[model samples]
Target chain A: MSTLSERILGAPHGNYVDRKVDRAYVCDGTGMLTLETWKRMGAARLSDASRLHVFFDHIVPANNSTTATLQHELREFACNSSLTLSDIGGGICHQVMSEGIVLPGEVVVGADSHSCTSGAFGAFSTGVGATDMAAIWLTGETWFRVPDSIAIHLSGSLRGGAEAKDLALSYVNRLWMDGGTYCALEFIGEGVKTLQMDERLTLCNMAVETGAKTGMFYADDITVQYLAAKGQTVRPQVPETCTYIRNLELDLGDIVPVVAVPHRVDTIKPVQDLAGLPLDQVFVGTCTNGRYSDLVRFAKIVKGRKVAVRTIIVPASRQVLSEAVRTGILADLVDAGCTIGTPGCGPCLGAHMGVLGEGEVCLSTANRNFRNRMGVGGEIYLSSVATAAASSLTGEITEPEVA
Target chain B: MMQGIGHAVCLGQDIDTDLVIAGRYLRTKDHSQWVAHVFEDLDTSIAPRLKGAVIVAGKNFGCGSSREQAAIALREAGVVAVIAPTFARIFFRNAINIGLPAIECNITCTEGQKIRFNLADGWVEAEGKQYPIRPLSPRMQEILAAGGLVNYWKARS
Candidate 1:
C-alpha cells in the first residue's frame, strides 16, 4: 500500500527511489522569459519538447510593452520548439492542463504555484521555479524528496451557505498557513464523494496557502467522468495503504461561510462576524474559484441586484468565458453592473486590470489575501464567489442566503 | 566550497515571493532592477540591510509563486545566504541552482546578530552557539560550486 504521492512518483520513474519526473509545464509569468534567458546563457536545448506545456494567460492581451514583448518571445519559442501553446486568453495554465493535458496517477509539475489545482484529478502535481523548469526542460527530469503525507478526513456535507472555499479557509485556519509545509495533504473521507469536481479543485488549489507541497484527492468515478467530459480517458488509482504523519477530521456540516482577513491566509473569521465591513471592490475570479460553475454561482446571486461597490468578474479561462456568454451568465452579471474583464489573471496577480487603491477593502474570491496582493495598503478579504457577489450588492461583507 | 559570515536580517514565517518582489516588477528580466525592489513591501530599509547579510527567516520562507526571480533578487542584492527552518520547494531549488546557499536550521537569532555559515562544514554559527545544517546534495553542491546551473551544465558540456 503506497500513498498517492508514492504511486504517482513510482509510476513515472519505475520506482519512488529516484523521484525523477518527466512532465513539466510553464506559464507566461516569468517562466517563458526565464527559459529564454537560460537558453541564451548556454543551458541545453529542450529535451522532448512535447512534454513541456506553455501558456500565456498571466497577463493576457498584453498589459504593457514589456509583457507584450515577453509574450511575443514565448510565442516564437513555442513555434520553434513545436510545443503546444495556450496563447493569450486561452486560459490559465492550470485550467488548461486540467482540461486537456493532466491525467490521473501522473506526476505533474508546473511553473506556477497554483499548479496544485491539477491535484483535483489525483495527479502528484506541485509548483517549481524557472531554474528548475529550465533544468527539466533540458533533461526531462527533476528531483523530488517524496514529501510526507497529512490526512484530512472530511465528513458530512456542507450546509448553511458553506462552500468549498469555506472548507478550504477552515482548513487553513486549523492547519495554520504554514502547518503543511513540506507535506502533501491527502484529503479523504465520506465528504470527498459529495464535492463537485470544481469544488475539489478549489480545495486543492488553496492547499498551497497552507504551505503544503500539494493537495490531492482519491481519483474516483467523478474524476473519470470529469476527464471523459474533457475528451480524455483515465483509470483512477486509489492507494490501499498509506501512512499519515498527522491525521485530522473535519465535518463539512460544521463549516460556515468564512473569510480570510488581510495580511495572511490563515486569519479567518466567519462572514457574519465581519458583516457590514465596507467594501470598495469585489472580485469574482482566479484559478482558485473561477470556473464555469463558480461564475454560475456568482451570477445567480447577482442576477437582479445592482452592485453598490465596484465589482469585477473575470472568468478563469477563455472556455469559461465562452460558456458564460452562451449561457447568458455574462449577460446577467453585466446587467447587474459587474464589470467583466478578460479571461486572464486580472488583479489577482496585481499585474493589471482592477488594481486596488491604497487603504481600500476588497472582497475577492481569489486565494491568498496576503498584504499587497491586490495592491499595497489595500485590504483583501477572501471568500466564496457567492459571498463576493452578495457583498457586492450590499457594499459590505455579507454571506449569501442558502437556497 | 561556499562560506559566508554576516549579520542576520530576520523575517517572519511565510515570507512569500510576492513580498520578496512583486509580480509587477517581473515584466523585465533585468536582475539588477529586480534586486533594487527586494523586500520593498516588508521594509524599504531591509533592501539596504540585505547586502552582505544572511537572511534568517522562520518556517516556510519563500512560499507562494514559482517566480525564480525571488531567489535571483536576493542573490543579486548581495545576500550571501538564507537560513530558515524550511523553504518552499521551488524557492529552495531555485536558490541552489542559482548558486545561492540556503541552510536549514531551527536556531534562533536576532537582527544584526553576527553569524557564520560554512557549506563544506554543514554548520551555522551565531551567538557563541553552533547548529548543524544539512548539506546540499552532491548534484546541488556541484551546481553551486560552478556558480549556477547554466555554468555547471556549460562546464560539463
Candidate 2:
C-alpha cells in the first residue's frame, strides 16, 4: 500500500529518503545556474556523467550575447564533462528524454518545472531548482520527502473535439492551483489505455500546474507499447496497491474544449464561452503540445484553410520536425498561412521567435498563461492544438469542430 | 536560534515565479538585474521595499515555474523571509536551498507592519499575535544554518 514515489524513494510518505538518480537533465535556462552551483560546491567532475544530459531549448539560437556567451560556456562544460548534449533544435528536454531515453521505474530529475512530464512513462520523475540539481550531479543522489499520492481515476473517452490538453485543463480546473501541492497525482483507470503516447505526455506535462510533485500512470500495456515502438523492451511495473490520501474522478466524455484564461492556468472556461473573443496571434508548440501528433492535428484541422490570425507553429524537437516534414504536414500548415519556427520552445517564455507584443492577446498551446510570460502586458490563453487551429481561422477564440 | 525581523510586504495568493522574476530577465546571470526587476510585474514600486521585508501572502506562494532565480532575486533584494499559508513545493525548497527562510503561517499582516519570526521556535509574531509555523526538519535546519546547501555541503566535505 504505497504510491510509486514511496516505492521509488524507498520510504513511506513524508519520510526523507536519499535515492540514486537514473537520469538527470537541465536546459539552457537552468544549466548555467546548475553548473555554477556545482562548481561552488568545489566538485570538479560529475559523479556519473553518462546519466546526466544538457539540453538547449529555451532561448535557443541565443537571444543575445549574454545568453550566447552563457550557452557557449555550457557547451564547453558539457564537452569537458563528457555529458550528453542536445544542442539547438534538439527540442525541449522533456520531449527529448521521452524518446526512449527515460524508462519506467527510473528516478529521473530535471531542472525545469515541467520535468514532471516524464512521469507519463511511469518514472518517479520530478523537478527541482538549480542548486538541488547541482547536488544531484555532484553526489549522483538527492533527498526527497516522499510525497503523498492523489488518485485521479479517469473513465470514458475524450469526445467532441476534446483533446488531452482539454482534459489536462479540466483536471487543473478541478484541482485548482496548489490543490495537489507536495503530492503525486497517480492517473489510473481504463481511460488511461485509451490515450496515445502523445496524449499521455500532454496530460502529464501540466501536472506541475496543479502543484503536483508528478502526475504518472503505471507502466501498463500502453506504456510497454510506447517504449517498444521507441525500440525498447520492458516489463510493465504496475503496482498491486496504492494508498492515496484522496481520490478524485473525471469523466473524459465531460471534458470539452477549454482554455485557461490570462494570468492564471486554473481559470478555465469552455471554448464556446470565449468564442469570438479576438486574438492577435495563435501559437502551437511547447513541451506540452508540440509533439508530432499535435502538429498533425493542427495541420488536419487547417488544411486548405487560411488562418485569419498570425499563426506560429514550432515543432518540439528536430525529430518531430522531420516527421512533420516527411508527412507533408509542415507543407500543409505553411500552405494554410501558418509560419513555421525552429524546432524548440518558441516564445513560450516570451524569449524570442514570436514574442507577443504589449497588450496583445494570444491563444497558445503552451502550458502556461501567466501574466507577462509571453510578453510584457500581453495576455495568453492556453488551449488544445485543435482549438488553436480553429481559433486561427477566425482570429478569435473558437471551438474546435467535432470530428 | 534562526530569527528575522522586518516589516511586512503583503501580496495575494498564487504569487507565481514569473511574477517574482519574469522569464525575459533570466537570460543573464546578473543578480542586480533580477533584484531591480523583482516583483516588477506585480507592482513596479515593490522592488524598492523588498529590502529587510517579510512577505506575507496567501496560500500557494511561488506557484509557478521552477526558476530558482525567483528565490535568488528575493534573497538578493533583501527579503528576510516569506510567510504564507502554503507554498508550491519547489519554490519552498529553492528558498531553503538558497538560505532564504520560507515560513508557512497564516499571519494577518498589513503593509509595513513590523513582523518577526523565530525559525527554531517555529512561531511568527506579527501585530500583537503569534502564529505557529511548521518547523523545518533537523537536516534542513542544518543546511540553513550553513547559509545554503552549497555551503552546507562545502563545510561537510
Candidate 3:
C-alpha cells in the first residue's frame, strides 16, 4: 500500500532514481533576495518562467527604505524574468497559491515555511530554502527524500465555539513533543470530511509547528467544490491504500477553546484554565485563521460592543476583505473599536504595525507563539478567532460560551 | 577531512530561527549585521560567546521561519557547528547549503567544555566521551567541502 505522498511522487517522478518536484514558488522575503544574489553571481534561469510564482507579501507596501528597495528589486526580477508577481496586498503567498496556483496531486515547493498550507488541497507542498528554490528556478527540479507518513485519524465534530485552530492546537499539544518531527501528517477519517476548505487550510498552515514536513487531507468532494467555486474543474485522485509509520486518533468534539502560551507553539492550555488573564492586544487575522468565515465569527462576538483593549483585524487576502465588506463584517469590526488593517501579513512577525511593548500580553489568531514572535519582551498567546474576539471584549483571555 | 575543536554553549529545545535572528533584521541582506544579533532575544550575552564555539542544543535546533539568514547568522558568528538531537528540516538543509556544519547527536556537553568534531569520522568528542553522529549524504558532504551550495553549484556549472 502506498501513501498519498507516494502516489503523488510516483506520478511526477515515475520510477526515476531521484524524485523531482513538479513546480516551485517563492515569496518576497528570501526568494527575491536569493534570486538577486543568483543574478549577481551570473546564474540565469534554465527553466520555463511559468514554473515560478513570485509573491510580495511578508513585508507588503515596504515598511522601510531597505524593505522598499528589496520590494523594488523583486518587482524588477519579476519583470525581467517574465514571471507572475502577486504584488503587495495581493494576499499571503500560501493564500494566493491555494486560491489559484496549487492543485491537488501536485508536488509544490516554496521558500516560505508555511507553504505546507497548500497541502490542504491534497498537494505535496513543503518549505525549502532560497538556495533550493534558486536551484529549482534554474532546473525546475529538486530532490526529496520521501518522508514517512503519520496517520492522524480525527473523528467527531468540533464543539461550538471551538474551531480548526483549537483542533490544530490540540494536535500540536499531543504531537509536537516527538510525534511529527520531519514526518508528513496525513489527516483522515470522518472528522476530516466535515471540516471546510478554510478550516483545512488552517490545519495545514500550522503543520510546520509540529515539525511535520506537511499536513495534508485527502481531497474529496469538499476540495472539488472549493476548486469549482474558484472556477476550476478537476477531479483530484486519492490513494486507495496507504501505509503509515504511526497511527493516532482524536475526537474533535473533545477539543475545547485552547491557547499556546508564550515562547512555544506546543505549550497549550485550555482557555478556561487561563480565563481572566489580562491581555494587552488581540489580533483576529493571519494566514492561519484569516478568512471570511473567521472574520464573520469575530464580528458575531464583538458586534454592538466596544473593544476593551487594543484589537486589530486583518483579512488574510484582498478577496477575503472584499467579501467581509460586502457582508458588512468589516463595518461591524470597525464599529466595535477594532483597527482594520490592509490585506497583508501585518504584525504576525513583529515586523511592523501592531507590535506589542515590553511586559505586554496579546492573544492572537495567528499561528506560532515563539519568543519575540510578536515583539521583543512581549508574550504571545495563540488562540482561535472566537477566543481572540471574546478576549478583546473583556481585555483578558476568555473562552467563548456556546449557548 | 575536516575537524574543529571548540568550547560548547548548550541551549534548550526548539531554538527557532527567530531566536537565532529576529525578523526585524531581515530587512537588510547584510550577513554581518545579522551575526551581531544572533540570539539577541534568547540571551543578549550569547552572541559574544558564539565565535569559535560549538552550540549544543536540544531537538529542533533551528525551527520556525525559512530564512536562511538564521543559518547564515550562525555561521557568520563563527559557530563551527551546531550539535542537536534533531533539527527542523529546512534549517538543516539551509545550514548545509550555506556551509554550516549541523551535526545530529543526542549527547550532552557542559557549557564551555572543550569539544572536538571530526567530519570525516562523523563523531563528536566532549569531556573525553565520544558520540557518533549521523553523517551527511554524499551530495551534502561535497557541498560543504566546496564551502557552500553556491560554490558547489558554481563548480558544477
What lDDT is reached at residue B127 by model 2?
A: 83
What DockQ would candidate 1 receive versus the native complex? 0.69
- Report the C-alpha displacement of residue A262, candidate 2, in angstroms: 1.2
Best by DockQ: 2
For candidate 2, what is the DockQ?
A: 0.85
B-chain TM-score of model 1: 0.95
Chain B of candidate 2 versus the native chain B: what TM-score? 0.97
Stretches of candidate 1 off by over 4 Å are: A11-22, A40-44
lDDT value for candidate 2? 0.92
DockQ of each: 0.69, 0.85, 0.66
For every candidate, the chain B TM-score is: 0.95, 0.97, 0.96
Query: For model 2, how does the per-residue alpha-carbon lDDT over A247-346 read when each residue is reduced to its tens digit?
Result: 9899998899999998789999999999999999999999999999999999999999999999999999999999998999999999999999887889
Give the candidates in order of lDDT, highest first: 2, 3, 1
Which candidate number has the best TM-score? 2
Better of 1 and 2 by DockQ: 2
